[model samples]
Target: MLEISPAIKNLEKEDIADNLLHYVYNTKHLLSLIKKGIDLDDPSYLSSYRSFEGEVYENFIYEKLLRYAEENDYITKFVLKGFHQGKCKAYANTLSISEKEQIVYRTKSREISEFDAMFLTKNNELYFVEMTLVKSVLKLRRRLRKKKALLEIIFPNYTIKSLIILNEGATGAKQFPSYCKVWFTKEFSAAEVLEYITKLDKQKLLPKDKINSKKMIEAHMLKLHPFRYYNTMSWITKTIRANKKYVIDMNFLMTEKVQRYHDLYNKFYVGFLTVKEMKNILHLKEGEYSEEQRVVVALEKKHSDEIVVTYYIQTTRKNLYLYSFNDAKVVKEKKDPYGITVTEVFHINKLMNESYLLSISQVNTIKKLLKERFKRESQKPNEK
Candidate 1:
């Protein structure tokens, strides 16, 4: 027999509800109503209930229990079904004997019933669970017996177990049903139920291990589809296009593999030139060659040659003059003549679709010079 003291009955309900509410809110409330002495079994009380209409009570309980098991670290991946109070059956047998002739007859019977919760743990073990804040010990025992019988028939492969969470103090030392255990609690706290659930999970009572493996395998297989690749590429393209601050450098074009493929394709594959290569490809050199003096007057012009600036000069005195972009004409005339002077240059080249060159490495210095000359022709107003 399972009985709870009057004082502890509501506490049991509250604890269960609190634990469940951590995962399912509305169910917690309904359990709260139950704890508050609202008769859930009463039809009138159910009629006024809102939240999720059409099967609200069943849905609420189902979702709450599902979330409860999940949150408490119990296996929740198993299939779920709701049983109405009078829709299931308990197994029973009756026998009749004939008095005169030694004839005997027997009959098997069943009655419809419902259970509060059912769980299948990782080990494929089935648990028939029943909960009540009801003070009737005999009634609780009867309910547990009935649920146990049905579970045995339905889940024969599983080791059926029953758990009765009650608020009543211990029901003396009476033998409970064959496959039943009861947990008595004094108050409603989600933590306690979660702890109990965790213990149960650790015992390998839930079918979590098998379910997780199956789910993982299925997910991995899905990733092998071509659609996944296509979607990944599309995502990369969209992300690159969205970021306007950065440039895409495909320097892998210089690798041996890329070069080999490009050669095999015979110019059909340009092999992904980098921003630097693109800049070099579009560079134009501009310098004045004096045929009679056998000297070249070289300078980087700005704004389509609208602004002339001499960066280097070879004079008749065998001297070289180096001038920076911001230097005055007098400063240019004062510098020593042939010392291989270096200056930073900024230019936009149209060859790679009008991209700007900020700084060039020593490897791309010639390209930088060519771009400086091209900038002189089509420099934009924003270049300065």
Candidate 2:
């Protein structure tokens, strides 16, 4: 079994009110919960899922990998459900039991569950991923071997590259048994996994030959419970979105004067803005954002021509990912999250939905709205 650090374990414990507060600290779980309507305000809803800290780490890596892939077009296209853009579709924190790729276990009487993360390149190659957060090298290595065999059996026609992402923080050498590359989360950002997969895609690493019968492979996956992607998603989404800034690390996000604007009108991958420039697009006079908590802006073609700005707090994250897209050749501006300064922008398109910095509101209304909305939606059924 995978083990979690005490700090991570505390994330799934009861809150000050003794309400079951879990999954609210995970990003993958947050998105899944919102999409599934799993209420966080009620403790009864929490009893339906298990609270393993390793799942939190898996969810973070899962979402970040997909985000990185989308921004760089690593997989060409993606979906939360089924395949849409031909052969190049990536699924985040979802199962593999779909009609496209599923293995039935007659002996165990079940089907293979969802993977920590999975991706198919435009070239029809597969990157089967299993993320682990543990301190036992023996257990970690054993899990990697098992996951690899299962992936190959299910995807016999394609070239498979099975990878294990190990999250470690020690300042010492972390060794892998040559099965796959070992990543130190303390040293590298989760998004960097996309770049590694891209390299593997170009080189075309083939999976070790396997001839396991379909029934045998299915039995193994079903019995081992090799991967999961559901209940964990519902719990974590509530956690991360609940306090996005606190739940998320500083690596993938950054804040500036125009974060809400960039977030609202994110056309380009990266862009720049000044309060003065947005005056034209928003039709607001100077010092309009002086109060800081709220503002307004015009949209080119969206829900509305003009939109209101709401304020919110987030511990999971508190920054915007603004990238400038040049078709396939994209360049992004990034910064190391260890400092107080914002990263430099390498590319920008002012004509696109030119963003502007809104004055900061010395209020927490945005935060409350976010909490209430999540609970309110989670309580509702997902319907048309």
Candidate 3:
């Protein structure tokens, strides 16, 4: 039983239509719609509806939490605290929630683990809160266990409990860990929520002896979910590309092993040479050097005369990846949803092709990619 706020439940069609109209006007699509005739079935309206549809459930839960917290006085404030990062405090409007915190691994692979919302009590008790519309209990269980294991590595001393808020009428609530507090929407009361928080204070912390070391935990996680290297790399690549900020957060560091990556990222952001300086290094003029979104400059030598540089350009819609090699050229093809493609052309020089003019550490990363990709390819026939 999930409960939505009365305010949200009472939203009228006119109210929604007004918001849709606002969205179209702000996006400059309203004039187009006006010219084309006021069709409610237009893609612009559909897009607005789709976006609105996605937020409804999220708003419901957030509004529910805010109302409960305000009525019950269950929390002091919402704060974001990381393992090595300082506390980031915000005025408490919702629950004591911190969202999308990451755990960086110290292994050679540099894998990462990210958790959703965390609710922290004044007494340092933590609730790893997961709010989901997913109906499958098995999927939920697997995800929570992995998240718990990762949290243990970073917050071994904290009394970390689990609170899973599933959609109303979802089943298999009894299948979750006994320590986990599972609540279906509309089923639980504010008093029960308060009681859940109180009980965690008296609950025993996880035995330090039972918790595995970082290496052991990594091994165990890999065993539980195979193809871990590929999965981790994909996650990192998607996260970085989506953010488009290029600057890696300094606070994500947990161990010395990941410092090299931080340095590499810094090389792109903080160590980029100016266009004039780049021309001096390469002995090329304005017409001679290649330029795409920006003046594509040679950052370093790959082969004898071949050079490559890593940079990103901010476009009207979003930032895009642009790299330069001696013989490099941009190829346009079918644009993905993000309007990017596998379109960078370069000479097949061994060093440039193998590592794309990257550092020795980056070359080692290519080696890992080769190992993982070929391993999967080799396994494909066995599945048949």
Candidate 4:
């Protein structure tokens, strides 16, 4: 199954399965922003970013990489000489996750495993990329080195650029493998790279040997045998501890994180007000058990003070007000965690009109169901 929790390694571990369900939803918000060409730098995007697996960073890097590849000669069509003067052919790894799809090394008989991305140059050169958001650079290096070897064997005719795009502060070493290069995202710019990739096509390029005349060769050797490098992310982490800001600011992360959840909560909260609509607020699927589970979660959120939600009768509107005082939590009561203007009268009239049609008995029934759902949520018997 696809990993729903961000904590797992390649969806191989189910340790954090209990925290599933949100990852799918969170990615939706981030994807929407990316489509709008929104600069991926603000506290809203950055703070909420860490909770995801490498896939989030991978997608971010994909945009930059794709942009870079297109502007450069990497994406030329298959010409008689195999396009772009036979220089490059780079694209994302488009394969199904359920099957065993890989290139195998005939010598070692080892598989060139799934890649986050790929770049093939007409020089018959291959650039295999590994994108990561994980904090452990030690683990990342190990994984990438193995991948580097497998990829080289897979594309025997091609020279390989074993590249890993690490998030800032992921790698501490001033020196690393000349062959296996690590790019810290903050230090690189997709826009700048795209602009230059075009111009680079016009500029004459040097051979690989020239880049590895000195310590670069040693770094390449170290990557080939990554086990020798003990000085990794550990040193960077220690330095980060001294200057606290080197890490993500906790205040920004927490404030923005909760606000993100609030937006999701209110997405269902504000528009629908009535026993019927509110009762099914937590209902992610269709079924009595699922509906009951939703009630339990909703009640839990309310009781824990994570949200200030309540139900009241709207005399003029002619329905129950399943209300949340979320405006109080935001500054100036601008948005109700949902990014919706809290006091906007345009939505006010529509929101007021779009209420549930509930009889008093139905209301009472739903309220009793909530109590029962809350009881079941506690996993205690018959108390409700």
Q: Which candidate is the best by lDDT?
A: 3
By TM-score, the best candidate is 3
Q: After superposition, how far is residue 10 of candidate 2 from its true place, in Å?
A: 20
Query: How large is the C-alpha RMSD of every model relative to the true structure?
Result: 32.6, 22.9, 17.6, 22.3
lDDT of 2 at 29: 46
Q: List the candidate 3 regions with Cα displacement exceeding 4 Å.
A: 1-55, 70-77, 80-116, 186-384
Which residue ranges in model 2 land beyond 4 Å of their true spot?
1-51, 76-108, 111-114, 122-124, 170-179, 187-384
lDDT of 1 by residue, 38-136 (tens): 775676446433332312333333444444454443442333332211122222221111121111111132112344555556665666556554445
lDDT of 2 by residue, 209-295 (tens): 222221112212222233322222223223322343442211222233123222322211211234343334334456644333222
In angstroms, give how far residue 199 of model 1 lies from its true place: 40
Which regions of candidate 1 fall more than 4 Å away from where they truly are? 1-64, 72-111, 168-174, 187-384
Rank candidates by lDDT, best first.
Answer: 3, 4, 1, 2
lDDT of 3 by residue, 1-384 (tens): 123334333432222221221111122343345456667687886564334433344333433443333333334322222221233332121121132222233232223333334444556555666666555677777666555654543455666677777766777888887648776554322222223333536443332111112211111122112223233333433332233342322223213333323222221121222334444333445754344323222222122211134443323333333444334444222222242111111111111221122233433343354345446645666431
